[model samples]
Target: MSDFYIRLYKDSDYKVARQLFNSGNAKHTKKAFKHAMRQPHIWPPLLALLILPALDIVSFTTSIFAVVGAIVFLWFAAWRMYWSYVRLCFLDDMLDIRRYYLEQDGRCFWVAESGGQVVGTIAASPSSYPGGENHVELKRLSVSPSHRGKGIAKALCRTMIDFARHRGCKAVVLTTSLVQKDARKMYDKMGFRLTHNFYRPKPFTKLLDFKILFYQYDIPKLQ
Candidate 1:
């Protein structure tokens, strides 16, 4: 982190960001989505696994072909669910970076580069919800696993807070999953207070324990 430089995101940074985003989801999609499977919006395969036993009522096992058909259908549903979770949910913003992250007013993205190579990233923009116009959202903070513990994450977090302040934001907010333990600790140390804790019932009582936490950094009033 010592040699790294922080700068505004450029058009060229898109490729690296996209790659990083995809690699991140490709690696953790299963575990993260698996944790939230009870959420109505993710992982259709496990749902099938639970529901398939009921298909005995439909006589799916009546013939070898029926069984094969059921098997193929389950496989296809699983594939679709994986695709939806990873591409549509995880990488949705990166799918249209310019439109989502770059084109908005009061929006900005930054990258941490070392040796001319991008290794860390963060973004901040004004919130869209009512009463949040004065608030900023710090998002997409990613540091290469290899670059951990060198103060890069701290620098990026500080960068976003400062950016928000400079942008005249009253506060900056961010959300993270319970899985991001290290990040949660860092945010606590950085003076971000927990503002919300909620669970999404994606599909009802089936999947549980999908905890998401929101943190807020309130800017002090001017003298």
Candidate 2:
């Protein structure tokens, strides 16, 4: 951790930051595939497809096509799910961090550097969630896969929390997925409390029980 330092995001950090963000999001594709497979709705169709062949109701060749089709569909669905999020991020704040964060008061983006290379990123902006106008939202908190367990994330989070405090924010809020267990644990350890547990409203996401967790850390009032 001593080898790393955190600083305000700069124009030169764009390439490495985008790479880190894309890779971080891409790593979840496997998890999404597994999650989709575990759904009971998914297994019912697969089981029915297998049953047809076992009962000789369908030719073995047909069964092979059915099972392979199911697998391929699931893989493609997972790929779309992962890339959809990446595209959304690019269309949103990541598309121009300086415009969304740097140019606004009570907003900022930071990167963690080690030996002149970007290893992590995080950003904070005023919240838009209901009843949270005075709160800050933490976003894009990702650490390089090779750089985990070294306190970079915590350092980045601490920086955001302090930034919120200085801006006189009432609290800090953020959203994450259940698949991000390490991040969930880190938020808990940092005194952030769960505020909402909900799934995305998309049909497949709801059917698969994919959940999004919201958390908030209340800032103590200054004397």
Clashes of each: 5, 0
Q: Please report the candidate that would top lDDT against the real structure.
A: 2
- Residues 17-109 of candidate 1 have per-residue lDDT tens digits of 766655644544344544554455444544454455577643434444555564455444434443554566345666666777778877778
lDDT of each: 0.70, 0.88
Model 1: residues >4 Å from true position, as ranges? 25-86, 89-92, 204-208
lDDT (0-100) at residue 201 of candidate 1? 45
TM-score of each: 0.70, 0.94
RMSD of each: 5.9, 1.5
Q: lDDT tens digits, residues 1-223, model 2? A: 2889999999998888888889887887778778878877888888788889779899888987999998887777666766888889899989988888899888999999998889999999889989998999999898998889999999999999999998888999999877778899999999999988987765556645568899999999999
Error of 2 at 185 (Å): 1.2
